[model samples]
Target chain A: MADEDATDEPQGPRTTTAEIVPLRLPPVADEEPEPLEDPRTGDVDEWGRSERVRALVRKAYDPMYRNWFRAEWDGLDKIPTEGGALLVANHAGAIPSDAPTIMHGVETELERPVYGLADHFFKSAPVVGTLWSRTGGVVAHPDNAYRLLHDQNQLVLVFPEGSKGPGKTYNERYRLRRFGRGGFVEIAMRAGVPIIPIAVVGAEESMPILFKVPSVARALGAPYFPVTANMALGPLGALIHFPAKFKLRVLDPVTFPDVEPDQPRYSRSRIMDESEAIRQQIQEALFDMLRQRRSVWFG
Target chain B: MGRRVLVTGLSTFWGGRVAQALEADPDVDVIIGLDTREPTVKLERTEYVRSDENYSILSRIVKATGVDTIAHTFLVVDSTTMSSRAMHEINVIGTMNLFAAASAAGSTVRKVVVKSAALVYGSSPKDPYWFRETDRRVAPARTRVERSLLEVESYVRDFARDNPHVVLSLLRFCNVVGPDITTPLTRALRLPLVPKVAGYDPRFQLVHEDDVVAALLFAIDREVPGIYNVAGDGQIPWSEVMTIAGKRGIPMPPFGIGLATDPLQRLGLVDFAPEVIDLLKYGRGIDNRAFKDAGFAYEHTSAGAVEAFVQAMRLRDTVGSDEVDYRYEEDVETFFRHSPAVVRDTPPS
Candidate 1:
């Protein structure tokens, strides 16, 4: 292996295993630092620094990068303590910002941290791409979801309303986006966890979506919002961050009975119907709480 | 010329007083009071039993005292908003036990007169028509207690139909008020700013104890069977009743006190039970034309009953205070249950 790298940057020859072997090790100071804790288990003694550095970078982007938009949480106690949780909240706000707010809610009120499924755009930016890997925020794919929850014992938070959530016009603010698919319910059923209904009141007003940009979507190779309509021509997106008081009421957890880990998962249709019911319950509770002006805002 | 009579539920307000009155009568040779409780009041010719073995007790009493005739004024009212199962145990099962025991004894038990509430006349406020024995069966409004009352009525009717020999008399009473009364009426009277909800316009006709007692005696004398409306002869509005109570120095509260907790009086919990809410929302102010036509005379008017209650309050020094007087504490429990079936069976600690 040492004899293979006769020159730097290997002349126009097919790469051999020996040539690549020398490039693997680096000076101690140049190496990326170890993660303070594992993203999955938070264990330090097992994994290498490169893996830890990736996790650290992801962790750093969460608060700072996400804080670029205003968010709030209320009644975070509804998250369960030990088992995997399926958090179903109303999806609104451009780029579906309620996800981070929900993560913060569970993390702050509950001792456990939540793993959010970020859209494909976060990975499109190289810096954001690295951050996603280290922080454990995946590509928000449907197939990887069930495995993430069932195996990891982490709280799975999803808007369920998808892209239609944040793109809802101002007239539809506070009204929830339609829950198109029910895969979240199936994941919860398979994992045998309680579905926690969360009502996010302030997200819609944060970065209101006026219109979708098909051109920007093509350029970025993403199907969802290219630029928040509030940000399209400018100042409105900044104005939208008016520190709106947000109330998140964690409703009583709805648990599906008799689903064992070894048993077959629930059908997509049944899960979808159950999820819609859970969402409706949250919406009704939110309307009642908000109409009563009984929000428990942090600020 | 001696008349023998057997009475069950004599520890109840109506039955207890009736038992006391019957035992005092010189013409009544044997007065056997069958109760689930040990008979506390003593009478010269009266024997008491604390068990519901009505037939066995009646047979034993008749064998001892040569009782030739039996008359019962057994009544059980569901005063709490418990589950139907609990209500059935106390009201249905308990009544069934009494009736079974009485039947097995083959004593001269001839007639059983029950005291029932006129609230069964359908708790609807618009019950402007006078309720008769033949009136349609009013579906029990939502309160579990009211439903329980209806269940008790059903049992009585069913038992009466099954036993052709045993005569059954049902005395349906309206708001029976007297001084020292802790009824829902009295409680509402004490509320400050009580709401007369749009649909709940209570035109209450409160019966006096004297009149109610008179009606019971009337039933005993005539051996009246079937149902009869027994109450005072006035259609007094709930507001007017409150005014009368206020004039008598009873606090006419302007609002409902039971919706929130009243610290000094834990009694509100019992008063505001869901059953009572059903009674409040829909109970009709009953007509007492049946008893009146049966030659049953009412000595005390509705106003007189209110006056007597206020006077009793003054005598007990509970005229204005909401606190329970030690002497009347047992009465409150008896009055709340409206049943000798409850108090007679349990020993007072």
Candidate 2:
């Protein structure tokens, strides 16, 4: 019976299949053959980013981007036409509209793909995670960032403040959160990419968090559950953002000449200093943008 | 002067396939296959040696046969196939003994090629888009298969470190799909409605079984002494993979998937193990560039592997179960190999 089972196993089918379809032999060492055509049926790339999905999303969100926020960009040309750059920005609002605004703006203006690096929390959610990935959101892992900036030579947008920026109450809106252990700076240094800081205004007011329900957040295994002013509009408020004039100011690209790329480790103090300087620059830029802004609803 | 090779788990798919490939090479003078059961595949010149799962007599065989290359393909990456304890014995203890024998005093083993799975990099939401060889698992292994594989790899790592002279290469292959191999993913794809985690379309990296065997051969031939991830180029989402296979996905509840699959397992419908469930949720991708850099070319991309598997499935459906012609008869093989009456054309080296 065991012998029968053994005979019934792979050998028979494998040989028969070999007769039908010729076995592909490995190419000789020097002469590499053309790679087998990838039979991918979807547009999703290795990073889970889909141009088709992004285009569809851009189409749906364009009305909100143009009319609702009326997002305006200053010194957009300061971003390089080519090569990799880490676009560091201040994150805010209940859901953080700044990321999409910046990504959509830069993608539309410069015609380059901008990958928004967010917390892995987005990836844990079922439908949300899939949507986030398809629409060009990658987890903010140093390895993922390095590959994006160095190997792929693609523009990456990251919020150094992280969930803290979005988790803050309405009162603590513009105040910058502590930059995450300066890991982003280290990644930029290692990837041999310059850090381009951008200050975003009106995101804090877009969906201002009145308060947070910690118990509910803990129960739901969420980062934070925020009760925003939009909640006053009832259930739909969670998805809706107030029409705040979104103004983005791009600062000069900061490069690290002293530190070498692909180092196992960089100077801790150096990373911290660079991170703090970028934060300060963005903070100052935010205040300047806010000062120039005549009104919240209209710029 | 030719290579004397020892292949573990001869009865298993990988072991039999590898031994068969080794037999075709004129340089491989002696092929001694070790397994508890008779080899499933018929081979011309390979000698089969029945051994316990832990390989108690491996040292004696290694010393007596003077096999220079050991292809360790006995590690169980699929948890659903056997009990946890049995799997532990085969994967962990089997590997421990194999390495012990290879590293024994004055051992003739010069090269060791292990067929490991990409399960070492656990599927998780925290994982990078592509796991490089250097990247450690984002989370601690929860399943028995993963834990056992991890333990086996640690042994391999230690063995490599201790025996610097031995050209030890650990090839971590991703989910493999092809005509001959049967894996959880392939089994699922074969189903009428491929089971998926609801609302999660994870990207999976699949390699062809041929690529896997070729990678093992590549490692053995070149004597590459580093861990390499052997996966097909590119990753395809689960939905896309299903579409390519011409099957619609039947989604299991995202939470409490065990509740749904337990009954299926009871009914012998599908064996959805915990690790496979996690994989269904968040599929894994590993960087195949390292092996490619070492001059090993893959015949199938991830999607190509799926296409090949689907094509083979279609063929099987048309062919009405392949007829098993070559049955392993011990006496016949023995007579052919050792009979003095038989004329010797190409004498054993």
Cα lDDT listed for each candidate: 0.56, 0.88
Candidate 2: tens digits of C-alpha lDDT, residues B229-299: 99999988999999999999998888988877779887877677888888888889899888887777788
How would the docking of model 1 be graded? Answer: incorrect
Model 2: runs farther than 4 Å from truth?
A1-28, A31-33, B263-269, B323-325, B347-349
Q: Give the CA lDDT, 0 to 100, for residue A135 in model 2.
A: 96
* Index of the highest-DockQ prediction: 2
Clashing residue pairs found in predicted model 2:
none
User: How far off is residue B228 in model 1, in Å?
Assistant: 0.4
Judging by lDDT against the true structure, name the best candidate.
2
Question: Cα deviation in Å at residue A185, candidate 2?
Answer: 0.8
User: What is the per-residue lDDT of model 2 for residues A112-138, given as tens digits with 9 covering 90 to 100?
Assistant: 999999988888889999999999999
C-alpha lDDT of residue B131 in model 1: 56
- Model 2 / residue B178 / CA error / Å: 0.2
